[model samples]
Target: MDFDPPSNFSPELMMRDAAAYRPLFYDPNTTFYNGHDDQHPRRFNEEVTNDWYDFLDGKLTREQIAAFMLEGKKVAAIANSSSPKVKAFERFVRLAHQVDNYACTPINPWSYYNNPQSDTPQKTSEELVEEAIRDYRAETNAFLKNRYAFQALKALFYAGNRDAFERFFGEVEPNMPRNTLYYRALGYRAGFYIEVKDFCNANLLYAEVFNHVPAMRPVAATSLTLQDEKQWEQCLRAASPEQKTALWALLAFRTGDNDRAIRSIYQIRPKDPLLSLLVIRFINENEGRRWSLIGPPTKDADPKANHMKEIPRETFDLIRRIASEEKTENPFLWYAAAGYITSWSGDYDGANSLYDKAAGQMKAGNKEAADQLRLLRLVNALSRITEVKGDNVERLTEELRWLYKQNSYPGYGEGGMRYKTAIEQSATYLSTLYAKAGRPELAEMLDHSSEKIAQPGVVDKLIAVLENPRTPMEKLIVDMYPYTAEEFYFYKALQALHADQLIEAEALMKKAGKQGMTELYTNPFNDYILDPLDAHTRKHIKEAKVKYTPITLIQKMREGEAKIARGEEVYNNSLLVGNAFYNMSFYGTSDIWRVPLLNASIFELVPCYAQEMVMTSPAAKKYYRMALKAATTDEQRAKAVFLSIKCDRNDCYLGPIRGRALCDDQRYMNQSNSPNWLDRDGFGELMRYANTQYYRDVIRECGYFQLYVAKHKR
Candidate 1:
């Protein structure tokens, strides 16, 4: 008899194997391009490869990718399914994390609306009904012989045509052979019965299907859940041999019969994807004690934490064995889930081995999805380091950095957003670790990297860094994000503010704000209008309409390329130049861009450079200032005062990159080391502002302010 390796088995080989799959020099910005690769070759053809690269690089829009995939799916049905084109099509969809074949029902004819108009031809009620019936017939005709005929029948039921649906459903039942069509049709009819609340017929049909088709037992179980407890119990009692054991396992778990549930789960063989998932769910629920991490608690007052407790070694092995036996399109997820359980159970080495296996399997199939696998592996590795695991910290951090590089590389496809949540979580954990271990620089670096999916925890970290008196003003003022020129300028302003160079700060702030607003603040009049306009309005339409303008250096470069491509000379133009006379104000700067009060407030909370913006029109600031002065209500006055102070504080403290740095120059993650007079938290300063009773009276909604007030009460 063979026994499993002990929990403390060496994971060095597994770690090394996992690291080998990661691409060298992975950077999201520079990996993929529009043309075919000569140096770094791919297995796919030119068009397919280009499309993949374009999709990954953010060049291909979501709509374009969707349309391409849809067309490919349609063509694959009629064309030689085994052709390279079809394979490419299938691979493309998989790369984008979409299914090649989708189960989509036709739209109901009743969903269409006929607009009433004097000039439009109108049909009689009988003709209208006849038209709807004809359309429905055509729709059913198209899908009847198709694999999704059952879905078409279900569509009829959804449109409230119960009589027609029943008639057609019955007609299709007897002729339906024991194939995918037969299974699907039976499932749909059973679902229809459930929808009509005919529990007896639904249960009878469910029992028949569950008994005959082992594959659809999972679908049947989902439907069974909607029934009353008595009805479900009756169905379970009448379940066929194939489904009886699964249903028993489910019922046992539901009723807290742990031993029976575990036994039933173990007895289950491979190839039962749904049952396997159910077993996994049972294990997770028991292991979590409450599946709060999976989602919010069902009860309002329920605790929101994962209370992890190690199960018996036998139980753990059983679950792992079940996951290993799974033979599905994506068993890697099950493997990863098992790994998560092991890690949570304090078996770190066991978890690493499991992760390594999952990553290996996923990489063998689809290289694109392997990024997600790597992300999971790295996250688990980070989770294992509780009290700074010596060399493991640097190793894990390097792996995380590699993961970031892969996610950022344009060659990876449009997965940055998809993988962002995991990446951010890992970054947050690593940052927190670094901060606690007396590595503020690394902590701050990781903290900045985690901003894409940054939470309130990120704000807390920023507050901590700023509050640390030992942290140099230069370090704190470092450009946390320098991806964009606008951000760079804004960051520099913060640095200037820290250095007490108010003039430079004000100028930089203005420049940064202008850059941010120029791109984001588009003209409202660009979209189509609803109706005819008055003569006066029509006369002003030409002046009101404005074209899109490029503001930042990147935008300017793109626009210039398009213009040059159109045979237009764009360089050496005096019209594009700005002549600034800056030594004028009390801050020693000329007229400059300043962030709007609303944007300033938002940036203070979120702290991303892209969130920084100036007033689009100079008059808007004057108008807003006038509005502030005209305010009479306490709430209005309080908000205005806070906004003013926030803007002033930001102008004085926030700065951009000044010297060489370890990180990239992207505005999104830039951070400076400089310190400023105002705290990054700004709570104390705000509390001071709200010192007056009237200010305090209207600040009830602001929780931050409330907390500050509570901490420093008179």
Candidate 2:
């Protein structure tokens, strides 16, 4: 029933740096936040190191502090420590970065609202990414603080410092936006490889990015030629915007299969300069020589303004004239003739029709040169249409959408900003369509629209739709209830959705995407209820040997009711949910099989009630201690505090905290810790109770958490 966020959510937000949260040089007046601020500028005055050490008072034990200090010796062995302070810092980090500390809870967006606001804007996602990149660039210097290490490591990897990259990879936060940055880096790497005449590896990376940012592409041949690389031409063809477009154009031209490419370019908004640039490049490249200002001038513009140098008036007009067409057309002629064209962007189906007619025209004994000229004219006409900016957007929206969807529209070609514009236009069109259609429901359990909810016995109808086989009704229902995984209950909803219920019937048909007024029968129903269990018992299931049976999924979750509970923060779940699964598989693939599904099962199954303890309660205590030891470069003391607390606890339980909980022990991040928090944060056994009990208070608020805890009693 909920609405998805508009697709226009800027990717930059995900890139901001997290180090900005730390106080800038201990300004007590403004210092509300004090986590790892890697971006903190180097100190200006005499170092007031003691101020940091003061913050750790009372929370961490002496033993833990010593353990944290001793741990840094390993890091010191690899990279030259900036100062003795590094060893002291690592000692505390070792203790803090325990597997026990890692387990506890998933992130709760709602909890953020309760916390005191910091004066700082907090790091934007992009800034964080930049910080990571910046870290990568610096070849020397071990990370002084635990908080900023992950970001710096990411930067090192991006900078291609192999030593820093490997070290950082070993310690990266498993859930950091690895894909986002990785793709960009990979794209650059691919381009680099192409430049060096390494076509095979270059293509592999290019193909990888293209898959995620689907409908995405390459670099210039000039550098390759300058380097005297043997495959300079192939690299240029692979990376250059102009060459890539022509290749696609030629592919479409020869085989008449331009659906994918045409659709991709057509998706680009009309005003995008890259679109014009692509056109200009296509023109010059197709002719085997550059042309005078066909569109925008090819001079560099201000990066901030992203200005498009004006095309010559004569060129603009010539293209404009060709754009005013309704006939089926081919756009390549537009480039040959320096004019615009109507019709689609050489879509295979549309281009096939025009290609036949052009062939017939040549068969009539037309002059060979004249026929070639006419053929060029067709290319001009179609290309011009792609170039033309439409009037009255409302009237032209559908046409523009069709145009945007065309293969050769040049929207997503390899130019700098083209893909963005294409993404923007396609997203806008999608938003408009959704608004017009009235927030189309996923046709699971209807809870949003008044019309859907108001019908007689509506809840029942919603239940029947949940039972459908085509859709993931069980999963959907489980999500809606936020309860344990047992498949009973919702009986009232099922009975109501039975045959002869028109409203529910309509909903069922809607799930199936059907238009019907006839047979208003209810969906089939099955019973799955049993007497509720009275006690918890460990009846090991499958290979993992986990599950609290007899207790049922619902009852187990009640065991870990948060001593204090924070409300759920409903961030978009599907993608993040997938990401967690990806991380799990990333860790468990070779080391453990059933990784994706196993991680997915746990991610979805947990009510995440332990968020309070795992993130805020115990973990926060250690974080303050690290900041304190960092004051006099006392890495030794910090390690003791971490080990005292972390060693006694199983780190496997703290995965969510390590992933998103902002723990002091972030230095342990890597592919290995994805499935288990203990592996990420905890050392041995520090907690006084079972791992689940330590965070049990937070888990109880969730019916699902209670079910899991009770059901999975070991």
Candidate 3:
């Protein structure tokens, strides 16, 4: 088979090829803005070849969408039917990663939201303020192409990158056209001044913002310090009749204006029962009804009770609707049924899809999902009804038998009931199968199988695995998994107390250690091996205490890139950062334990700097090119799609890049990307209404697939 195909292939395989060419594109969890993995270039775009009009027209047929669903030729039909909009956005996302000069890209509905560029770098704070003031006057559209540029400039202002921010602002301001949201941008412009701690300018900008954009006063007020509080309050009192209302409304909320705050909210959305409910809920959630001695005496219990008692009429209506026959399956029921069915049906793919869909419906912090998809494989395997994918059932059985024969014992761990039960059932099945096969040497075969199945000397290991302190006892049990003798030794080291006990166990483990089991015995917790004879010896003690300090992905990728730079070409994504993390240390958990926590503070930092490498590193490019060239599997193709998509976005990837920037900066993205519907603002209902329509559109299209050109190679 050809290791890599030329670009001139059927459109059916184009997405696959692009995916193989750059594996990052198809990652569902990994999102990109205009390509390059959200990393911005330090300099200029190297591959500025295409004008990329195809993205605007949405004419691109991304065949990879098919791979996500069905396999092979079936994908081609799906790709052909996809609308120009889907294709356009996907292509834009891919191109934006590498594209520079966002201004040159064709104007589309989304162009207004696209990030803009600075014509020149400003060098002073005065220059920035002057330029910002001009832009604030010019831009009429609340949304514009320069929004991201403004945002970037705003960030630099906060970072104290004053000169650059100033220079950047100087270029953007004079030229931008005034539009509906121009005042809103000006309001943001004022906020930018505040971020740099410039009070005089901030007040001027805020004055202008209140003059032009009245509703944002409360939001702006929250960011002010105690020193500026009175001036703001005074400004609130002295404002004109128009500004006075909004100004005092915000000040009143700060100075015990609960009624105005409530009224102000009512003015925005006249009958938001949810807002009313939450006001009461907040009182209950934070125990807010209690009054301090500085204010009034408290009857906290009564308010708390009243807050609970005053349920909204809308809520009652919702409670009824939820219980009644709704056409859509309740998220809980759908997931639970899907999980339960997938478990024993050998429908791993289906089960995984169901769980993903369920996750989309789940509320934040809600842990009790319909059912976890984790147990799907186990359920499927046990049911023995769905091993259609390459005869895994026969393979798993034969492999288990062979493993037992090699060990000469198999009852294995008696630790967890699950583990013990699995081993026992496995042995019982093999015994029955062999006995049923019936041969002249059946009795001898049965005896040999029984010896192998008994799990020779495995009780101690089970006890070691179970005794660990963590609720996840599995973390301490290494070899107990996939059941083999070497695992017994790993568990012995982790659970052992006295050096003598360790030494004795060490000898048994070493004697038991065979060729395939050696990798498992290497101390997953520590760097060096433990020989029980010298467990207490200073040398052994010092060695055992050594644990791997995790290094950044950049360092590992640099090493790989350096090798590639030197023309050493054995590069694999798994062996790169993926393997670096994978081999870091598992201690006793599953292989997935090595992957960083998705929402963890540090783990979120991991993908941030990847953008920089994409922009600056030739080795990184070479590696990516080779990876895309070599990718053959559907999973590999998916990764390629992600990388390519990142490259395709017309702007350098900033979000992930900056997120990585703030990784070591020890910052978080406090600015939320939550859909506009969640806020209590008037726009919230409109957003919800729009989203409802969109969702309904999708549901109407659900299982309502349209056929396109049927041929794959065409």
Candidate 4:
């Protein structure tokens, strides 16, 4: 009955404005650290387009440039103007293309390991490398020179001329402006350091790139590698305060030890925006680990201290201290995060107080933040409700409606708010409360499942409400009920049929409408008792000539019962009724009848149904006994005895209590409680007709009977 929330935190709501960093947080599309591929490329394209616009002095429109760069349109075709700026832009674009041809091709790190014969990269020619170097030497304009230097560095690095790459980097890096292009060149040098196995220098360079280049931060962080503590310390020692913060950010991402990273970055720069991302990630991870409000209480003596053990003491203190200081860029973020942690730890009062403060600090018209605060407030309200009765339900109706609305239409709220966790958690909380309030029908409706609905009386209560919902709570339950009235009627019919209430079952089946016409692939009154485990029996049942819908089958059984009542062909009528009951069971071909009724698999019906109704086949056994009493010949009597014994054998194997002692295959037939029905009087009567074709058929087909006779003879 435990219901764990899908997730308790909405990273999209928290970081909607921080689009560059959004991919770094929890995304349903990708695992942690495995970010969205488009984030970096999108940022890179935006920055590059801006730089290109400025470089061309707006000679070509931004739209034209975007189409040229992103849509693979030729630059010459987009910029047909003969101005010097456009001409210079053309040269720059050509050099950029040459550099990108080598740089942008994806390098599969596991190519050699995964496929030894994987194709190698197409090499950049020496002539192209030399031409890039010449372009850098000739360019005098600072912007054009930086662009040329980047191309030259990329070309040399990709050309496998490590000596030339280092020589050119040493000459050009000092004069290069610390912009995205400069960071791009620096990233190449860092890759070289990693190639040379000097992880310390490589990590240091990557940290610098991470700190300076916002568009390339993901790439830099992914590339930064500290093989051991020695290299980590070496990088930290050589890094500036900003670079050190970037290194800590990478550490937080690589290892989920965000508390240390947040503190380390906060110590270096209290106002660092990275602190917000790290703190939000930390809070979200904790939220996922926190216990549900209705889950098992913690070991703490106080009933209110349910999830106190889930929150890390140190991290909680750190978040509280930071929120109190209000130093981070998003003070509202810190306060809201702190409030959520407090709420999860069972301090509803303290949590609401912080939430109020967070609301006060939140920027007006910030819908995402406003929605987050409202959700938290709702959670606090829901957590405080110890009982679900008239007063509490009335008081929280609006909030509950809002929560349900958000879940029903995800785009209705501040879009992409992670409400799945809250929705599932609230359902569990409300369902548990309703159960305690002696309203289990409402509980089952809120947390509807085949297993819960299959519990006795749940369906009857559902049927009552569906028939006439007088109360507001009943109407609400009806609104939230997942299945239609027809399905409920069909389910009721199934239960009735299980209990041998044929008249009620027929009435309910009539109310089931078109659902009652769902066809069974095989005959329900087929005299051959099917073993579900037997391949041949399954094939034979699949190829059965007779097909009957639920209504038709029930009507047929009713007709047979009427014939039995009139004592006309009483033995045949009894046998037909018995076969119908038997085939409707878990072991029989017509178990497919329950598939649509329960919305469960044919395989799952046995476990999903009440064990006694299915496992014992009591109705079928009763009818078989009636058949034995009316039988006029040894063949008829023998058939009745054998079919009844099949029911007893099934009961031994499947009955919840009797099944336990008889389950061991090695001790199956020898068990003290095992039903050796073949040794009983009916079986003795069947044996008296040993020469009959019916008895011969039973002996040939029934393996258990053969084993029993063999044991008795021994």
Per-candidate TM equals 0.41, 0.22, 0.21, 0.73
Candidate 4 lDDT, 1-714, residue by residue in tens: 023234455666676356666556643234433334456445578777888899888778888888876666776645667887777877777777877687667668788898866747766888899899999999988888888888888898888777899989999979988888888878888888888898888888888887777667778767878578887888889888988888898898877779899989999998887888888777665554454643323476655554534666888899999998988878888888898878767788898999999998899998878887888888888887778756776576677777777753242122377676677778878888888998777888888654566556777787777778876656766777776677778867876887888999999999997878878877778777447656776765654477788898888988999999999898899988998888876677676445444433443243344444555577888889999899998888888988887787776555334332222334434446433455655455567778789887877877766766676667
Best first by lDDT, ranked: 4, 1, 3, 2
Write the candidate numbers in order of decreasing TM-score.
4, 1, 2, 3
Q: Which ten residues in a row have the lowest lDDT in candidate 1?
A: 574-583
Prediction 4 TM-score vs. true: 0.73
Candidate 4 weakest lDDT stretch, 10 residues: 655-664
Candidate 3 to truth, TM: 0.21
**Please, what are the lDDT tens digits per residue for candidate 2 over residues 263-284?**
2333433222223323333332
Candidate 1 residue lDDT tens string, 1-714: 011111111111122222211121112223211122233122223434454445345444444444455444344242345544345434435422221112233234554465333233222233333333344345432322332344445445444456666787676566455654565556667777777787656756664555455445444544544346687667656655556555654454335444455555345544443343344334434533422221112344334332233355666676687557666434665576677667656566887888877776664656544655565556566656764455666555446556555442221222132344444455566567666776554465555542321333443344434434343322322323223345445545544533434455656656665543453232221211111123532332332233332233223433433563464532211111100111111111111223331122222332342222221121212222333555555454444445443334334433432111112236424565463634344455345445555466536544445655676675
Best by lDDT: 4
In terms of TM-score, which candidate is stronger, 1 or 4?
4
lDDT of each: 0.43, 0.31, 0.34, 0.74
**Which structure is stronger by lDDT: 3 or 4?**
4
At residue 667, give the lDDT of candidate 4: 40
